[model samples]
Target: MSEQELIYLLALQKVPNIGDISAKKLLRTLGSAEAIFKSTKKELKLIEGFGDLKINSIHDSSYMEEAEQELLFIEKENIKVRYFEDRNYPDYLKHCIDAPILLFQNGNIDLAHKKIISIVGTRKVTTHGVAFCEQLIEELAPLNPVIVSGFAYGVDICAHKAAMTHGLQTIGCLAHGLDQIYPKAHAKYESEVMDHGGFMTDFWSGSHFDRKNFLKRNRIIAGLSEATIVIESAEKGGSLVTADIANSYNREVFAVPGRNTDQLSKGCNNLIKTQQARLLTSVADLVYVLNWDIQDQKKQQTQLFVELSTEEQFVFDTLKKLGKSEVDVLALQCKLPTFKLNPILLALELKGVVRPLPGKQFEVI
Candidate 1:
């Protein structure tokens, strides 16, 4: 967009009470931000849901000056602005009704046809949580999925680091503007993150740093990915909010189960109990639930040489004989308990001798 067009868009974004949904309505009706501002109050009032207060806010001249200043910051910092309708904007996020009309991004980030997943949890993540987060990313690295997370303490940073270690792209969704990092201590990782993926936010430079902004930011994290995973969260926290937002967006939500008594596990357990999220144990669960096609040539070649154990062979034979069978039926037919049969099935899946179907059924590949 041209400088003048960007100025008008930034001004429209600054108008109070005109959120993304409302702004989109105005843009669609008026055709452009410049036209919206140029139109008379009478013209603006005709749009559905436009009230006196909203019209007055849109006509406010002060936001134009603020937009001009923000424009200068964008130019000076070489930041990339992603209009909601632009092709470069995040595909998953564009479907969200409340997604930002403008997203300010920095670094060499790419989202085209990427397998993106957001991992979020409590800031005070436990050692076990950290280990699981790392292991999860490491295992998923082979798929080359983009790892997205809030650039906060604990699990967020851990996810970013793990993704980087695995040579996968990672994105940090910030609550504040790109001009500054929230936790100053994270300054050291900023350059590395920028190099690997980048930082993204809707807030302009010098925007007020409010705690409420974090909750609002959760939507972006949830919106940008095909799925959102909560490794660990307290009974109440922002990660659960992200999970809820993901669900609202009709995206998959996964929660790693924990011991009932553990404080961090309460939130995940509650999510599972309420059927708000799928119970996640390993990468296999995510792959199966998402039905990701693993057609890589290398994996295919390895599958050809895979050697299944006696238990796995028995399970595979039983499943093949039945053509397709749910976990319970196969367990009974194989004379193996469900618990014992599950691992064997997983092993067969990894060996590429079996594929998981919907409703926990499995069939030979």
Candidate 2:
């Protein structure tokens, strides 16, 4: 359970073709990875799946050599490493069939028993899909649910950005090792997420973003969260893999409804019609299904109106004192220029710090 021991275990785990299930089986019978490491070829042969030929591979020296640089890097970066046996390792992820033997995490990791809702879908969602995800995520974000996603483009990016806009914590499950980002475009968002109490993944430094690894990564995405939502995906999109895995794990799967004839909505409709996923049409449905504390949060929200720019404070106070009103009324009340006030209203609305009603009207909703 010590860091050094876990590192050795993870190195063994990182061995090509050697998986967590087999490693755990060996550990259960033999005790620690240290013990497993000490075991001679003949003794390893006693385990069911650890054949003599495989046992011959047990004492292989490449593990230490392959992991030397990663160990050094981890030590240098001061990254927190947790193993399967560590209490800090997420319990939900532990329940999966092949959870990582060790995770190399680099950020604020909140394992609190909050509602975790994963949003995933096509990396090439349409404009409609983007808007759908944005509004839904915007509504759900204020409740402080733990958001999870693959950190890919389109819907994944949309969910993370939307959650972040509302100051929500969002974890990204990367397909490759934690050492590198696959899609270099997401670097800045990744940094923001890490700063805002989100977490990275399990693989070692040198793991590649291979096709099979992405498939394997889907299990963690499904297992770590309370529910998975498919925002928009074509029939053959990869996001469905996460939904399927979530279902197999007896977890909830939800999908946003899209136009029937739209090809991108095909996967979502398939999930809903086949009972693979629940249809989510509004934020209320998600909050209720997830049993999030939207009402409680609203009641607790004090409307401190702190950290406001001079203009924000002016607009905010005007609305606070007055009952329901229009944006123009507030603009007149604040006496601020239209350019500045409009964007501020939008920002506040997105944060749920303020809201807008129909008919050029604005009020807290």
Candidate 3:
């Protein structure tokens, strides 16, 4: 879009009570933001949901002045702006009714044919929650999924770090504008995140830094990805809000189950119990529920088995036959020494043919 068109869009965005949905309605009715501004009050009032007050705001010059100033800031900072109707705008977000009319982004973000998932949870994440978040990303590294998260403490940061550690692109959806990062302490990670993936938000440079902004930001987190995963959340938190939004968008929502008594697990458990989210245990669950190329996975599994040594194959076969069995039982059934079987099992685990369970039991993946 031209600078003039963008300025008009921004001016339209500045009109109070004219949100994304209303703006889109006007745009569809008039065909363009510039045309909307040129429309007479009678024409504007003719559009559904556009009251006399909202129609009058279009004639105010202050909004255009603000848009011009914001445009200057945008140009000065060299920030990338994506119009809602532009091809470069996020495909999934574009389908959302409340998605911003314009999205401001920075860094190298490429979403083409990428499997995207949003990871969210409580700010006060537990040790186990952190470990699970990291392990989940590590296991999914092979899939090359783009991780999306709020750039907050705990699960969000952990997901971003794990994605970066696995050399995957990650997106940080911010509550505030791109001009500053919230939680000043996270500033240390800003450069690294930008280098790996980058940050995104719909807020303008001078938008307020209010608590309500984070709640509004949750929609972007939920809308950008194919699925949203809740690692851990308390009975009430922003992560749950994101999960709810994702569900509302008809996107898959996955929540990791926790012990019933754990405070942080309550929200996830409630989500699962209410059928708002699928119960997530591992990457396999996500793969199965999302129906993500099971045939390809089977082919990969066949290739992996072909590369396994005789002993490794034997252990794999034994685990497959037993479904899930203790190491002692597996070693006995395979007729291999416990010591000898351990290495074989580890190799199979690394090959993704098998997964280890608690109490030394194992199961075929």
lDDT of candidate 1?
Answer: 0.90
lDDT of 3 at 332: 89
Give me the runs in candidate 1 sitting further than 4 Å from their true place.
297-365
lDDT of 3 at 250: 96
Clashing pairs in 3: none
Give the TM-score ranking, best first: 1, 3, 2
lDDT of 2 at 254: 95
Model 3: weakest 10-residue lDDT segment is 296-305
**Candidate 3 per-residue C-alpha lDDT over 1-365 given as tens digits, one digit per residue, 9 for 90 to 100:** 88999999989988887888999988988899999999998888777777878888888989999999999989998889999999999999989999999899999999887789999999999999999899788777767789999999999999999999999999999998888988899999999999999999988886888989999999999999999999989999999999999999999999999999999999999999999999987776787688775344434555622586777777787788889999899988988877556656654665667777898789988
lDDT of 1 by residue, 101-155 (tens): 9999998899998899999999999999999899788668767899999989999
RMSD of each: 4.5, 7.3, 5.5
Can you give the TM-score per candidate against the true fold? 0.85, 0.80, 0.85
The per-model lDDT (C-alpha) reads 0.90, 0.77, 0.88
Q: Worst ten-residue run, lDDT, model 1?
A: 295-304
Which 10 consecutive residues of model 2 have the lowest summed lDDT?
A: 293-302
- The pairs that clash in candidate 1 are none
Better of 1 and 2 by TM-score: 1
Ranking by lDDT: 1, 3, 2
